[model samples]
Target chain A: MGARERIWTAALIVIGDEILSGRTQDRNIAQIASWLNVQGIRLREVRVVADDSDAIGEAVNALRARNDYLFTTGGIGPTHDDITVDAIAMALGVGVEVHPAARAMLAGYYETRGGLTEARLRMARVPAGADLIENRMSGAPGIRLGNIFIMAGVPHITAGMLEALTGTLEGGAPLLSAQIGCWVAESEIADLLSEAERSHDGCQIGSYPFFREGRVGANFVVRSTSQAGLDACMADLKAALEKAGWPTIAGGI
Target chain B: MGARERIWTAALIVIGDEILSGRTQDRNIAQIASWLNVQGIRLREVRVVADDSDAIGEAVNALRARNDYLFTTGGIGPTHDDITVDAIAMALGVGVEVHPAARAMLAGYYETRGGLTEARLRMARVPAGADLIENRMSGAPGIRLGNIFIMAGVPHITAGMLEALTGTLEGGAPLLSAQIGCWVAESEIADLLSEAERSHDGCQIGSYPFFREGRVGANFVVRSTSQAGLDACMADLKAALEKAGWPTIAGGI
Candidate 1:
């Protein structure tokens, strides 16, 4: 791929027993994915693992090795189950230590609420040589060690961290998309959709079928890193649907 | 572990470019996880990969090797993007073939709507030696080969497949849980929570903190296979919180 066409990718690891146990529906995956898109980075993959150290370590190592960036949500809290720091440190062949800057930040944030107790101070711990990612929503900051980012499990806190890191990471062209919906079963236009995608370079069409109003319909999404490519592909797809006697709805149903 | 205490685990693979592109929020993970829990099987891990064949194949091979059961969602439609069958077949060292039962089901269902075209017939292709899992909501059925199940990406369709397979798989004891909510910061009683979990055998406690009504609060979830163990752990934790001058609410806040 050329420089302008290069794709920057990232992988996410959602670390929480609540999600795996079905007690909590994960909001971080979509949140992070949208945030990464604005930064011109594509979220290539995601893994939701438990709070176990071995599981955390294995996923961290595997994903970080392949992707341009690795992000983890959850398991950075003050509780005993918050073992992400230690596990990631072990995976990187490093030791965990309380970062002085993070300690000072926690101390300042907790001065009026309560002095930083041992439990609260646990949030200051980071893998060796890791830097802090500012957390505007809470006292404990997110950690960034090399290409790996350890973020809060809470969706709002993770959002704040994403905001802080915005415009800081190097990325490629943002992927653009357009949606066209039709009150026709996708199977009816599968050939047209496939042919449109094949003719349009660097564009992919995804057909999402739904059942509503006792009728079958589908919303076709076209994605491309190039705006012209996306527009051309969508135009051709819409024209193809029209030629097949199916009216298209812009922006989906 | 003893046979009575054995754990049955399943891993999930969510395949879709729409999810990776941040256009769609994935509902299958929580839905499947909750369903697996009722079946006395633990959802051990989840990976969301894109619609690419190699990505799908690699995740399918890796997750299926470790878990007792492996379930996949998405990429099973008649659209060209629906390549889960081919990818999984390649991963399992098998060939793809049109299953006669699946073909018959599609033919019968589409006979009233429209004659089954090649696009609709694509849904009948499955990995060689795969059995069809009934789909009452749609014509295309889910595929099951060995311990791997290929289900729909849509939540309701996946639920129907789960309903069909209920009580058919072998499982261990179902995990039980209780909840206690308190208006105190989790850090204030982190040590007590850790100690309570340590004292209880086979019981795990997860503390989830939230900000509500301008106050800090947390809900502690205690999980165990034995009801007595869960009860003992919850009682001790609640008493410990009460002794520390914090009131506890049963069933969480």
Candidate 2:
């Protein structure tokens, strides 16, 4: 194997009581993970915590200390329970202050519909020394402080913020993947999958088994930072599966 | 308010590379969270980690030490990456052993479909002193060791295991909740929601905003351990919204 490249890692904290109560299915984890991958930053961990200040603060401190970058979603709304900014500010031992740029943006957005009330202005608050992340979808903007990025709870708004952040952060090579699907039980060819992964340096294969159409099947996803490595591993896995009498379908089922 | 009851809490560890890689969207969180609420146990926190053993072991040790009950989903299959049992056993300072009951169950299950091979036998392994939580939908039984419940990563399989173990864990009163939807922006009623929650000692109000059908709207969810507390909070919140000229929908829009 060649010299290993620096791998950029990120962690996510999904802050909300709605999620913990099962009132809202979280959409940010998958979206953020995918976006991080595109930026060549691997999302290493995710934590879903309630809207409580202590819980949010604890998660923020722990995750931000460990990863290269940390992203948080939820609780940045115009409501009393939207305590992410305060919790994060407390966690960082910094005071919360309204960013002038964010305030101006909200003022302009809400000018026609309604004037910026105190509750709406609450969205402009951020940790001291933090900058604003543009949110094209709504009046409120996301926040960024050091390695931490605070995003919206709503999925579409979060997507807009992500679009704005594209290619801005430092990252390593993007991880590449190829999938092969077969109508065979994972246990049947477990050895082959293991052997293929072991032989391919810097490559990892994930087997996801499913019961579909009255038959057992599995999708093998081969991933690596090196496109050559990923392609080689996928070819080997596909050949092995086909040779074992389990016909494979490229790009998965 | 009456004397406060002991609140039972649980934390969940989601173990998988697929989830961390964004290859799979997690459905287990909502399902498990809803099921725990129905059983009167609150899901306090959740952590999603990679398939690495050290990551799993660390999350297991940290979360299990604090919560009354700790649950984990994923990494229980019969593949090279299926290392949850080993990781958890190491975390608990226990050795892993193949349970005869689980082995027998697997043998019976695969008797006609290939007869449990070495790879499939991997599913029978568990911590030294763990009991099996029956899987009505598959052969691999979930593990229960002390307060830790280790189940499958597959949503449907996890659902079946949850069904088998329903009403088995000790918990406090099931939390009650009611939702009221308003076409007005959440900022307009932020004070009302906060005031209603403060007036009702045991109640919590969560505001979720959305943009639908070219209008701004929000759903306010009131939750409390006591049904009376929940009903009173909901009534006050709805009345306050109506008095403010924003009509409320009973079950949310």
Candidate 3:
């Protein structure tokens, strides 16, 4: 491991009562985790909190302090429950103000549809000394204050904001993974998987077991910062499973 | 509120590398949250951690300290990647040991399918002083240590564990909710929603906005411990929206 290969980590906070209440199933964590992987950043931890301002503020402060970057989704809409901005601003010890450029963008977006009302104008509020992440999906721009990035709760809108932020953050080597599936139970080959991972430097293997078609099986995912290491580890794992009398499948069954 | 009506809160920690690697989408969070609500317990927070032992131990300790109850899902299987039991035992400062009852259950389960191998026997391990929660879906029983409940990662297995634990824990009155949907944008009625919620005691309102049928609308959810308060708030919210010329729908669109 060199200085240039330092691993970058991020944490995400999902803010919403709907998610906590089980009224909504969150898709942001997986989506953001995958996107961060492409950017060579590992999503280390995630906290799902209610729409309460204190809970949001505490999660923001704690996660932002530990990770290289902190991303939050939800509670940024034009509804009464959308209070992420207020909470993040309180966490940063800054006053919330309507950003001029954001207000202009919202004005133009609603000019053709319907005039921006007082409630819709709430979308332009941001913490002082913060920049905007362009949201082409909706005129209400995402907020960026220091290490924190705030985006929409909607999956498509968040995708648009992420697209606008592609390659903007500094990151390390992207993690590479190779998957091998076998019909044998994972416990039967637990020692083999551990041994393979231990022998291969800079590589880790994760085993996911599943019961399908009345048969138990597992998919072993080999991950490494280096493609060469990943390939070697996968090869060794597959060979070991084969030697143990379990035929390996290239892609998971 | 009476002494017996004290609210109970729980935190959940999802332990898995597959979820962090974006290879798996988590279903346990919503499932657990909804189940906790049915048990008259509010899910206060949720953290997703990796399969690493240190990460699991740290999250278990942190969440269990602040919440009345803490639940964990995943990494309790027989594979090397499944180290949740080890981590949780470490967190509780207890040694891991094979429970006699769990071993007997596994023995009976695998006797018909295939004789319990060394790998399957690993499922019998638990913290030094813990009891087993019966799992009708699988032979590997869920672990209960102090305030922490450890469950299987598989959705059905986790559901079975939750079912077994239902009505076992003391809890407050279950929260009730009433929903009213209107075609008008939420921002237009934000003040009305806030005023209605403020006027009502022991009630909180959450508005979820969506775009459907080429129109913007929102569903307002009113929650309260008292059914009468929830109904009254819902009536007020609907009347206010209707007075503003937006008809209300009983259920969300």
Candidate 4:
């Protein structure tokens, strides 16, 4: 793909029973999506599945086939339910064994409190031929096998791993966004928004409606990979809204 | 499938650029998952896609084919970006038309506020042969065609729609859960937890680890379709933790 034409995309598989069972509300999808946008990679799709190996393996294979990169969060901890590594290994048709460096790292981290037991040693297991992604928050590191990045389920640890990975991946132009909030119902100005998007090439607008303070309102967000296109779309949309007798707020309401 | 052994599953497609852009954090996934569980249906998988019609239609067809039910959230409002209904209609090989009852409802709703314009009337459109799911909070009702239920992107409106749908769909026995928390690193007791799960006939336990107050801890959640099995598994797991010198908290920390 050409430089200006190419749009890199990533798909995420969230592997956790807690999330599927509704015991834990996921915070990783938004975090990963926003982080990928900053890296100039679009988050194309996300799949949240149970801890079952078959489910994880299927999602990994399917998403990795279609996107530039694939990511999985959760099921990489020390417990038996932490089976993302094993599942991905199974999907890749490989055996999982303890990585020497990971083992040493875990041993060093655990040596101060207690010796690395069999359970703690489980954290060192990775897919064959996989490299480690540094985790500054915790001793156990993330895994990188080909285009797949295996991250921790915990939000803070995942954030740390993402921070370590900044500017490392190949990406296209970063997407830019601008928001305009209006007190009028979105239905009243829907045509104006659509017309603005139609006139501005390479830009898409999203309207999020809200009801607060006994009044209905909406926030329109305009996005484009080109800064010029984004500014043009926002300016046209704001002008149209104002001309239609609706007051606009620069930041959302 | 055996009457008692069958697991009813559903998949969700979240359609929006705002979610993919990370401008909006989604609460629908967890809410839908919890609601599905209460109805004795398991949420097998979830896919978050862009507002593009092809993406929504493809996901709708693929997931609805594999699961007992399919749900979609977002892109069903009055704005131009709200294309979920149109996409789903295309997926179902049907034409989009304004439902008479829905149009009437919207007309009544907007009659007092402001007359329903063409843009506001857009909310009345639905796939051919689709029925309306009541939305008591708002005039625009949700759409239900075949096994696919299309709901609002807003969390509260979605909640109201789900509430209207309670106990309407056929489902199996509700899954029961019990939690056990301990102030010990999960790695130390991973083997014991695995053994407990293995010994329990129908229970699956998930261990969620956390670090708080400068100490490591974990919450173990045990789930089973049978309440008796769930209780038994929780009891055994708690006893095993206490016997291993880890004081167990009845609920999660």
Q: Each model's TM-score, in the order given? A: 0.99, 0.98, 0.96, 0.98
The full ranking of all candidates by DockQ, starting with the best, is 2, 4, 1, 3
Give the whole-model CA lDDT for all candidates, comma-separated: 0.94, 0.93, 0.89, 0.92
Label model 2 with its docking quality class: high
Residue A58, model 4, lDDT: 92
**Model 1 pairs whose backbones collide:** A74-A153
C-alpha positional error of residue A182 in candidate 4 after TM-score superposition, expressed in Å: 1.0
Better of 3 and 4 by lDDT: 4
Task: List TM-score (chain A only) for every prediction.
Answer: 0.98, 0.98, 0.98, 0.98
Candidate 3: stretches off by over 4 Å: none
- Place model 3 in a CAPRI quality band: medium
Model 3 agreement with the true structure over B1-253: per-residue lDDT tens digits: 7766799999999998788878889999999988988888889999999888888888888899999999999988887778899889988899999999999999998888677887788899999999999999877999999899999999988999999999999778887777888898777788999999999998999988777787887888898889998988988998999999999999877
TM-score of 2: 0.98
lDDT of 2 by residue, B131-210 (tens): 99999888899999999999999999999999999989999889888888999899887888888889999898899999
TM-score, candidate 1, is 0.99
Interface CA RMSD, all predictions: 0.7, 0.6, 1.2, 0.8
Candidate 1's error at B149, in angstroms? 0.4
| Alpha-carbon deviation at B192 in model 4, angstroms | 0.8
